[model samples]
Target: GVSRIKEFDKGFQEAVKLAFNTVGIQNAKPSNEIANTTPKTVETIKQQEIKQEIPSNTYTSNGVKYQVATTGNNSFLLINQDNNKVVANFYPSSLPNVYHVEVISDKGHYETIGYSKDNSIIIETKTGDKSWVTTTYTK
Candidate 1:
């Protein structure tokens, strides 16, 4: 039964390759190719280091770095310098965080941006009046 199953699998693979070839794509691989493939050595793996750059006019507070760019009055964009992505948005609010801008919002709704005890940045977005979505960014 094991040999029968192996034969079925091989036939199915051949059928798939034929179907791919009919569509002008070659889905063929020699059995030795998989065994001959190169593996990553310790030296190759060590070359992959985390890359990050802090642009000018960045804000650093609580050991977290952010590229702060003001978009409007009392509104600024918070870009995670290490990740190079817009992680939080700051808006005018009576209440504030360590950045001390005011309120934080994602899409015109009130949100909160603060640091946790571990020194990571935390962003809490309010989807509704009593609902919140919290996101934490670790350095």
Candidate 2:
């Protein structure tokens, strides 16, 4: 289990770094080459697939079920089976004006998006703190 945990941490860091680097390099790369290129290997193709964002069925956790939806004015998150949509708001609590909202989707799901701050949410898949990753956007 320790080895597996180490492996996952390594992979997670590599994946995060690769994502940041890709964003930085994307503009510098020729658009025509990027647009026309095909995946050279199955692994590359899979990576491409993983980068795509797709909507999933609604879900919840513990005693609550939830879904994230967007309207013209605001992003809404509905909690419980009642399906009441709450307007997502961000303001900093205990840390200046920086506010954050955290959402954990159904288990086994990975999302790089969060409200208020980019990647500021944490999801615990295991029984420890290491099960989650968080990124906070700083002003």
Candidate 3:
């Protein structure tokens, strides 16, 4: 009976290996090896996540430069490159590639609308006299 049990166990082990091989999962690592490499794998994944979270490129318009960066939570910041200050906060609009921008100024807060396409961003703002002025920034 013991011999029969041993034979059954051997067959089960071979069956498991064959099933793994059929599914193209050969050379399965032992638990010890997997544990040893897990930290490195986690570190690599963390690095990739950090890269994905980083902000995108800088764009320029009218000799003034601007950088668009993510502020998390689906929000963004528009930074003025000349003074390195955050000039505006950008929130995503319902339309694709469009954002509602709030310009920060010493005078007061003003709202604008902007759209981005390819390497350019176009913003339309209302002047004090209620005239619309459009500015384009390019990468």
Candidate 2 lDDT (Cα, 0 to 1) = 0.40
Model 1 poorest 10 in a row by lDDT: 47-56
Which lDDT values do the candidates have, in the order given?
0.53, 0.40, 0.73
List the candidate numbers ranked by TM-score, top first.
3, 1, 2
Off by over 4 Å in 1: 1-56, 61-64, 94-110, 113-139
User: Distance from true position, residue 42, model 3, in Å?
Assistant: 39
Model 1 C-alpha lDDT per residue in residues 1-139, reported as the tens digit of each score: 1122357778777777776777885678779977776667754555554221212265665576777666754455777678776756555433333332234335444445543235444556556587877565454
Model 2: per-residue lDDT, tens digit, 4-118?
A: 2357778777777766776674446557977887767855654542221212245444445545453322323333346464423222233322334444444443333343323
| TM-scores vs. true structure, each candidate | 0.29, 0.23, 0.54
Residue pairs whose backbone atoms clash in candidate 2: 91-99, 92-98, 92-99
Residue ranges of candidate 2 with Cα displaced over 4 Å:
1-56, 72-76, 83-139
Question: What TM value does model 1 have?
Answer: 0.29
Q: Model 3, 1-139: lDDT tens per residue?
A: 1122357778777777776777884686569866666577667665643212223689887788888878875568878888888877877665556778888877888888877766777778887897999888787
